[model samples]
Each structure stands twice: as structure tokens, then as C-alpha cells.
Target: MVNEMKVAFATEEKNGLDSIVSTKFGRVAYFVIVELDNDKKIKDNYIIVNPGGEARSGAAIKAVQKLLEEKVAVVVAGAFGPNALVALDEMNIKHIVLSGVKVSEALGQITDKL
Candidate 1:
């Protein structure tokens, strides 16, 4: 199994070629889980998101909670939604918040911190 103690890095990740393309209007948090012993990673396929609007934080959190059902162990992000936080708490998913950092860079930071 992938490490249960695995950690997820949270950041602002845009799906286009660069960070600017995917999230021009509003930013959404990205999460990636890391395998502790082997240093392997599982990246997201599509964004687990709500309507991608302001004050729609609940959508973000619910999106995350849905992900938790898939057995995600951790969540790394710049910020979070309350629903997501509560769900994470219930599911026991570890969370990390990174501000203004690119997704790849944030992943590196999480790796080092481990």
C-alpha cells in the first residue's frame, strides 16, 4: 500500500501550461500525496472543485471531502474551505497549506519538510 503516513502538499495549481492559464479568474487549491519511503507521488487528474467562485468555499471543501472517500491521506494547499476542513477532520486526512507557491515548488517543499 502507499504509505498511510503519506503527506499531501497544498498549493495553487493551474492546469494549463503555467499557473496563470488555469486559474485566471479565481485560484483553487491543489493537493498531491507523497509516499514517505519511496518518494513516489500521486497527482490529481482533474481539479476536485466546486463552482470555482468567490464565497463558494463550501464547494471547495465538499470537493475535498469527496476526494477523501478515495482514500487520500493528506491535503496540501494555500488555503481551505470550511466544509473541506471539517471533512478532512472527520476523514483524518492530513493537511498542509502553502501560500503563493507554485504546485511543483510546493511539492518540493513538502518533500524537504518530510
Candidate 2:
């Protein structure tokens, strides 16, 4: 079967739907990876710990690299640092800013627009 495009969201928790949108992109504790079918239905989801969180400097670049290695087509975060933004743009990864929302709600909004 063909795989659909994958999206990643920086979140505060590990649980799928219950995860909270994190305020900082690079420093976020977890990255929730969600796979969507062509029809925009959620197919699968998982979480990864952000190793860049412990970096004293260059955390944003490291985070972007990690996400790129994951093959994520899009990234959703509350906010991104300048370096991270530039790197994401260079890598052709789409990014969306979303704060004060649950992961489920963000998914709903994204799918609705899709």
C-alpha cells in the first residue's frame, strides 16, 4: 500500500489526542508524528523524544534536522525560532503555528481545511 504524507506536531505530552501543543518548537519535549490517508483520515501516529531539548545552543537546527530525518512533510508548532524557520524553509518543510490547542483539535482544523 502507498503511504500518505506524514505530519509532526510539537507537543507537551506523549498521548495522541490528549497531547497539548507545545509553545517552543525546538525545545519541545515530544514530537507527535501523525500519518494521514489520502482522504485525510488519520492512519497512524507515534511519538519521539526531542534530543535537541538538551542542547545548550543550536537546538533549533538540531530539531529541524531530526524532523527532516523523520521524513515529515509538515510541522506544527506553537512558535519557531529564526534559525529553525530558515532551516525548515530550506528543507521545503511546511510549518504551521498553533498555540493553546489540543492535538485532536488541531487535527480537526487541519483536516477541515484540507
Candidate 3:
């Protein structure tokens, strides 16, 4: 089940979502967070991400998870490696993969969809 948790949208800039796409370990598609309509409406709440790496799933999840430690939920601009994915799974946080998209545009799209 998803929480009415606060979500984070990764952005390279403080303004709009940037073109930057970096996961801790892999290429980010987008970063987003959903209030979890029982965890099924993730697709509608996910947004684009702005990261600082090439493609490191572990590192990316680590970074995101670090932020998530307090928030409870996150929508990143990309996906995580098997290891990180498992950690999130165990914690019951939905790790939805938003592969290959702009953070700003993705936010608009996902928000509208949601």
C-alpha cells in the first residue's frame, strides 16, 4: 500500500525541472513522488529527475533513499539497481522507474495525469 506520503521531485535547478537525468547508479528518466493510491497510482505521480551521475543505480538509490529516510516516499528521474530496488521493496516504498524524460516536462505530465 502507498502512503499519503510527501514526495520529492529531483531537479537540477531550484526552478523548473532541468534536462539533467542522473540516478545514483544509472541514467535517470525522471524523478517523482506519489501519495500512493494504495500504491497503484504511481505512474500518475512520478516526475522527472535532475541528478549528478552518469548511471549508477546503487548510488542513485542511496542518494534518493538518504532523502527518503525522512520523507517516506520519492519519485526520481530514473531507476535503481537490483540491490537498491530490493532495499526499497523491503521497506515497502514503491520504486517506480521513470526512464528517459525531462524533469520539468515529466512533472507536468505526471501531475496532469494524476
Candidate 4:
């Protein structure tokens, strides 16, 4: 049987796999959720507008909470706020930081590790 997992990418736009990875995790505009099969190939994907992007405070925590609801196994971004990193650690969600890369490239870079 093949194992599958879902990874969420903090993105600057809602352009699916072509979306640029946002530099800031908490204030990102969108979250691209990609499901990967055991072979490290994309099985499915979608996008969600980040509610925490417009928050005045605790945006990182809010973003983490939103991802938790989606049940993502991992998260990818250019950078993670201090609070966001702590939250993700406590929640046991894995995170990868890859700056200035498109969502597709980020996936390619991390495929082997995932």
C-alpha cells in the first residue's frame, strides 16, 4: 500500500502550483495544500485564503490554528515567525523554509525528505 500525506505551502497568491511561496508565514495571502503520494508525486491540491493575514495580533498562532484544522502533515514557507515556529513545534507539525521559490519548486526540493 502507498502512504500519502498533505503539505501546506504559504503562498503569496492563489495560483495553485505556480504560486510564489510567501516570505512571511503568518501574513501570507494563501495556503496551497498539496497531497503527495508515496512516490513523491502530487496527488491532489487546493488553495485557501489565509484568515490570519489581516490580523492585528497573533497572526502566526492564528495561521497555525488554521492549518491544524486542515490536518496538514507538513508546512512549507520562506520564513516562519518565532511564535509560529514554537506553535508548530508544540503541535508536532513539520515545517520547511525555502525562500523565494515557487510552490512547485518547493515541493520538488522537499520531496525526498517527505
lDDT of 3 by residue, 53-94 (tens): 444545555545544554655455454677666666766655
TM-score of structure candidate 2: 0.92
The all-Cα superposition gives candidate 2 an RMSD in Å to the true structure of 1.8
**What TM-score does model 3 achieve against the real structure?**
0.47
Summed backbone clashes in each candidate are: 4, 0, 25, 0
* Cα lDDT listed for each candidate: 0.49, 0.86, 0.48, 0.89
Candidate 1 C-alpha lDDT tens digits along 1-114: 654345544434545212321222223544334444554453333343323333454555545555565566656655666656676777777666665555556556666544
Residue lDDT tens for model 4, 1-114: 858888999988888999888878999888999988888789999998888899999999999999999988899988888999999999989999886788898888998778
Q: Candidate 3: deviation at residue 48, Å?
A: 15
Better of 1 and 4 by lDDT: 4
Error of 2 at 37 (Å): 0.9
> Arrange candidates by lDDT, highest first: which order?
4, 2, 1, 3
State TM-scores per candidate: 0.55, 0.92, 0.47, 0.94
Best by TM-score: 4
What would the per-residue lDDT of candidate 2 be over residues 1-81, giving only the tens digit for each residue?
Answer: 665888898987988867988889998888999889987788889999888888898988888899999999888998999
lDDT score, candidate 2 = 0.86
Clashes of 4: 0
Name the weakest run of 10 consecutive residues (lDDT summed) in model 3: 21-30
Residue pair clashes in candidate 4: none
